[model samples]
Target: MDRFGDGLVFVVALVLIGWWIWRRFDNWLHEPPSSRLRKLAQAGEVEPDEAVDFLQEHGYSVLSGKHRVPLGVIVDDGPVQTTRLYFDYFAAKEDRYYLVRLERSRQPIDWTASGLRERLLPYALLFPECDGIIVADPKDRLLRTVRFRVEDEKA
Candidate 1:
């Protein structure tokens, strides 16, 4: 019966391994792009908060203030909650509002305008009233302003 017990043990081990692999794949599939961006910034390649501050220092007024304050509206005797919004920067003289998002990598050359555009599109939808969005790579001091195109869905 020793052989029979060994076979059963192997089967249980295989099942455990399969479960672990499946869990990892499931997590990877559901991971958000923001998580990847944060990892890049944490590697000492970029400063995301600094970029936001730069925008504010340049005269951009944050709509909901820092740290995304929760604004609620009462409906049906319950609070309707919405996300707190913050602007990266705004230029009052030019009537421009900027949403600054950061991207970073150890190999700065890999960074591209298209990649930045892909990340900022969601923010544009979130802040439809903003004049523009700035995808800033603080490590490289590279900033690209994507003009808000309310007419274009891609923006």
Candidate 2:
């Protein structure tokens, strides 16, 4: 009887593990780029202050790194919900707002899963509100904009 109970427990554990793996895989596929970049910025691998300085030197007036504002729209079964979008740094110059992403090179140098467009499109949706979205690689001393055109928010 003990042997049977152990076998049942093992099978149940295996099923649970498999389910968890599936959920993780789904997240990896659908997780937006902005979220990944935000995580990287928060990881402390690269100093936020350094990135802020870089943006400043390049003519970006850094406003704040984090803030919640009623900015985007989300449609659901219930009702249209206004979602607050997050950016690493919100900046402006000449009365223009831009959502900035500060990426500190943590890995050796690779773009396997994380690509540029995946992250930029979401920020672009803030069109008219924000002039555009810019991504900064402080370690590389490079800055680039993700030009926004109409596109789906998910992959």
Model 1 Cα shift for residue 12 (angstroms): 74
State the TM-score for model 1: 0.36
Q: Quote each prediction's TM-score.
A: 0.36, 0.47
- Residue-level lDDT for 54 in candidate 1: 57
Which pairs clash (backbone N, Cα, C closer than 3 Å) in model 2? Answer: none
Q: What C-alpha lDDT does candidate 1 achieve relative to the native structure?
A: 0.55
Candidate 2, which ten residues in sequence have the lowest lDDT sum? 37-46
Backbone N/Cα/C clashes per model: 2, 0
How would you encode candidate 2's per-residue C-alpha lDDT over 13-100 as one tens digit per residue? Answer: 9999999999999999998655543443343332357888899899987766764446645567666767675567777777666777
Model 1: per-residue lDDT, tens digit, 21-92? 999999999996555433322333223466655555655543322223245667788877565544333332
- In model 1, pairs of residues that clash are 55-89, 60-90
What local lDDT does model 2 show for residue 32? 66
lDDT of each: 0.55, 0.67
